[model samples]
Target: MSSATHRTAEEIGRTATGPRPVPPLGEQRFAADLSHVDTELSNGLRVLAVRKATVPLVELRVWIPFAGTDVLHPATAEVLAETLLTGTARRDRIAVDTELALIGGDLGAGVDPERLILNGTTLASGLPTMLDVLGDVFTGASYADAEVARERERLIERIAVSRTQPRTIAREALQKQRYGDHPAVREVPRAEDVAVVEPEQVRALHTASVLPRGSVLVIVGDIDPETIIGDLEKALGGWASDATAARLPALPELSGGNVLLVPRSGAVQSQLRLSAQTVPRTHPRYAAVQMANLVFGGYFSSRLVENIREDKGYTYSAHSGFEFTDQNAVVNIDADTANDATAAALLETRYELGRLGMVPPTAEEVESVRQYAIGSLVTATSSQTGLAGQLTALAATGLGPEWLAEHPARLAEVTAEEVAQAALDYFAPKRFSGVVVGDAELLAPKLTALGDVTVGAPAE
Candidate 1:
């Protein structure tokens, strides 16, 4: 090798002896001009329009609150969502697909305990056609017996397969442990119930719960906000309802105590799911709480992952996050570990939770996660689809675009002291209730030795 090249290589190696200081993150180069039109129609359906001329495409999201007290609501709603776009009064199944294809549009619907959502995308010029199709499905769905039967069978098969998953078992067990027999625990309905859901019942559910009165439609992309609302009025004016939108029963506050065990016979690994009651996004301390969570387990660099995965090699991945409903919110932590490492991983998890409260995060730790949080928020909403989905979900909880605009500032202003306080309040080990799902023979002793163990059937 030449002397100059060798010397240059040696200099680069010498420069790497100590850790390089990361450049400070610059101020946000662009404050999102989240200007939009938000309004309510005469029939009470709310419309939100955001204009982003980056691409000549439009994204649509519809949220209809469908909470019900009936145990069968979830099953019936699942079938309804699956078959919603299959056929309408004026268009048969094939015709519907063909028509949407002609306009370069596609749409789908899904259901959960709280809402039925319709999400779609189309060319910018096809917005009116998409809205018209949406109106057709909303007002004139046929819920044909053939389509319902097909979708229902498919849903049953999917649910049966999903039930065999460790994560699903753990989640259902945790919900039941937290909420008892509350209907809110029915995130996934019984497979048997879905099999028996008749077409007439699905149509009835569509008639009863799919109301425009309290629903929201979010449209984003290259479009004029003023012009789109008018188009929506012309398209969806026929879909009206006088009945009030259904509301879920208040979510019981999450309380932490003994751990529950769900026996998954002969399982190779355990899925540990933990949750703690938390405040809604509107809470003043939410920003601090979010940052504290990030430092605890919200990211790959979090203390929980650093201890249990990076340091100990317990599991492939672990995560902590928040789930928000209309007026309730909770923090969820999940990790899947080998049967042999389950106890050790759980012990480390508990240690990190406790340490975050008692020892608190150092300024460096807090600042690292704070930057991640701020950067994540900006990147998450920088896309049209991301912003549209976010805005629609927020609307269901009575929040709007203003909340999105102000949240970055709130996160930026959170202090290290405040994050520490939030950690102390919410990250106490005793404040988490969860379920460990694994083989009974392999995990029973280790889990029982860890804490209390309850052997019970997972909620149907």
Candidate 2:
């Protein structure tokens, strides 16, 4: 190397230190101006529009309370979502796709037990076309027999393939254990039912429940909120029905008792799934509990990950998160380990759960997690699509951009004492009950001794 370049490199390396202390965050709060328009149509359809001039595009989200408690509803609703936009009376499937492509737009719909979610995106100028297309589908979906038949066969094939997947198996088993005899347990419809679902059944389901009344629509883009809401009213004026939207009954609380072992014969790895009842998002203690969750297992540096993955090298990954559906909220924790290491991994996980509650977080730990929480929230809503999705979720719980803008303060205001109490009440290991899906012969021996052990097929 030249002498001059060598000397420059040496000078740069001299300043690279062993450790650099991170400066404390200044006493400045980051606030977002999330001004938006919220209105309801005469038919009870709610609309939330936010003007964001950052991009020449628009994101659309539609959420309908599509709950049905009957045994056939899950399979039928799945079929309905798959074919919702295949064709309308005014346009065929090919025509719909062609128009959307011409406008640089795309749309998709899916169903869970609690909601039917329709998500779409389009160029800013195509907002009218997007709404028109949505209106056509909402009011005039043909539910053609040929399309339904094809999608039904495809869905059956997909279900058959997914049933054997390890994650799907674990999730199904855990849901059943958590909500016995509840509709939530029927997330995946029975394969036999899917195979037999007729187009008539799907058409009937749509006619009965897929109405605009009691539904929510969130639009975010580089557009005028006032003009857009007016446009939405005009576009969806005809998309009305007398039938009220379907809604789920009050969800039963999760009952925690013993660990249920679901036998996946000859499996080399086991999935550890745990769940406990938690309060809904609107609960007064939710912010503190949310912080406590992060310190425990909600983030990479959480105690659960530090103990089970980083320290002991049991599992490669682990996570804990909340699932909110209407009035229900559930805390779900998941980790996967080798069949032989299953029991040990679970033991360490439970230990960390108990430790987080009993000992609580240190002041430094609370500050670190609180900063992480606030930062994550800011990052989540910084983009148009991100903000639209967050607002859409909040809309379901009777919240809007006001709540979105105010949640950062909520996280910041969570005290260390509140976080500790939340941990003690909610993060205790005994409050969680779940299923361990692994080889019965291998796991049953140790898991039987670990807690209550029951052996059965993946479905049982």
Candidate 3:
């Protein structure tokens, strides 16, 4: 009796408990309010400059709103922008690299769902030389057919490799489901598609789409604004002022209440995508929905993460959030746990979804996330580079800084009822698509109760 009454130190330590340290989060605010810089060139090219004088580096982001959505120009001009730096009108790829090293500079271009941007970085002192290369790539590009073929071959390899990556496959698969096989959702130009793009197509697309009429150039560095903008005008002053308005293609409506299973063999974990049409940046409920997502799965302490990943250890990480697009969009969750735990994990997801429109967040939870979310906003868009990145994205969808500034108030004003309402309105757990990659034979039997399973074989 005496021995039992004396609690061992080991037992005490094992049961030890104290207040859990709260996680870090961001608050709401405008990051770039300190100063703003933008100028339009004589060529009708808009130039935006930000002087982060503290740093010796400067970043340039040039925007052209010709994404793959345009059937006439599906990544033709964008791809050429990439290989342009690889080989110059004056030299080959090797020579360009050699010259770039002399000043520690490089260039690349990317096509997004809504914009085609040419982005690069260089030291502040290296701006003069970098500008020359920028002009050479854009105005004086010599698109030899040989380089186009080479890049197309590499694109095929990339597409092939993407099929094997589970998360990547799930993401692409989800986009395909949400947006259909439309060019907007279709990022990988197939081998056949690549073959159709001739050097002439690249050249023609460049002349037609990559011009100053609707372009915005962002220069971030330690430089004099007046001087830099002056230099930029000289280079672009003679550029074609003809602006060809490119209209965004209409996006398909996001419908709910369905399950799509892409089954794979040798599976250990399952990937899930829950989709719904959401309000655009201009919607009144945008903030409320953002707050709702915060309480749902935007953070680690979020309900989905806390329940499925941390508490249950169903997966390493489980989270969900909305992706804003020109049209209504989808919310997705990705995770990989043991095949056996798939059902339990999904059940938890369903339960959490149900809870959102039910209990709603307490004031404490709302305020905590509000501070974190808003603070997070400032840090996320603090850099000049970050600011410029957002401009083109907003510009593509007919939204801008004016729309973003009102976001905090909208978020702060949201209540638990609104979030619960949003959950009821947007989240569709029953019809969510689940794509599992890995041993399907072993995984499918465990997921029998979830829904009918479709086995997916590799694309030959």
**Which candidate achieves the best lDDT against the true structure?**
2
Of the pair 1 and 3, which is ahead by TM-score?
Answer: 1
Which of 1 and 2 is the better model by lDDT? 2
lDDT of 1 by residue, 1-460 (tens): 9865666544554555664555666776322465588899878988888887788988899899889888788899999999999999898889888878988999999988888999999988777778888889989999999999999999999999998777777888888888888777888888999988999999899889899998888888998888778888889999998996787788899878777877787788889888999988999999999999999999999999889889899999999999998899999999999999988888888889999999989999888987898788778777888888788878988888888778878987988899999999998999998888887778777777777556666333
lDDT of 3 by residue, 84-115 (tens): 66665676777766666777776778765556
Candidate 1 regions exceeding 4 Å error are 1-17, 29-32, 457-460
- List TM-score per model, in order: 0.95, 0.94, 0.82
Stretches of candidate 2 off by over 4 Å are 1-18, 23-32, 456-460
Ranking according to lDDT, highest score first: 2, 1, 3
Which run of 10 residues does model 2 get worst, by summed lDDT? 23-32
Off by over 4 Å in 3: 1-30, 38-46, 68-81, 195-197, 223-228, 241-247, 327-329, 398-406, 428-448, 451-460
Overall lDDT per candidate, in order of appearance: 0.86, 0.87, 0.68
| Candidates ranked, most accurate by TM-score first | 1, 2, 3
Prediction 1 global C-alpha lDDT: 0.86
